[model samples]
Target: MPKQKGPIPITGTVKNTTYFSLNGQYYERRKSSLTAAVVATDPAFAASRRCNTVFATAVAIARTIYPQLPTHKRIAGAFGQLTGRVYQMVLKGMDADSIVTAILGE
Candidate 1:
């Protein structure tokens, strides 16, 4: 993970590494070979599968509740913020059943 400091900035993949510029700075990272199918079906990606499942459930919950709310302005990232918090809770070992109960409970 070396920062690119040279005057001549190189961006894009070179062998096993990838270079990209962000906020006027350049950095390199290892290229990932993972794909959606691999993540879904691979035992090595069980945690990712769990997280994805939780995120999808969170999205569904939001969808059901969103239409019932009063028409109020929302922040640009509000949707992501809501779902991300749920995903974080999942990562922190919150039970899926408890999450569903909390969200859909009266």
Candidate 2:
């Protein structure tokens, strides 16, 4: 008899499923589920995904901050300018506090 081929078996437990060892070690396996809470719900992630919640909120914030830049292209340009300022600020300093504050922001 010939063996039938099928999809390869994977070793890890399924996502969102809790996996714990009889010993205390395997509990870390569920870290993604916990971390996904932050990654999945972050405002930047929502904005990048083009979610209405983020877009509308961003537009409102931008309008309040810069009433002259009512258009989307102008708002995008503002974002680019802000990003470039942030990049220059970080690039000018090499200290740990500066780098951390740059990446994490004040």
TM agreement with the true structure for every prediction: 0.55, 0.20
The global C-alpha lDDT for each of the candidates, from Candidate 1 onward, is 0.72, 0.45
Candidate 2, residues 1-106, lDDT tens digits: the string is 1222344422355665444453323332343534567757777567545545444444443344344343664554776554444445434544434533444442
Residue lDDT tens for model 1, 1-106: 6798778999999998899999888999999997788977899989877767778877776665445434563457766765675567666777656655564463
Reference-based TM-score, model 1: 0.55
Best by lDDT: 1
Global fold similarity of model 2 (TM-score): 0.20
Worst 10 residues of 1 by lDDT: 65-74
Clashes of each: 0, 0
For model 1, the superposed segments whose C-alpha errors exceed 4 Å read 33-37, 71-73, 76-81, 84-106
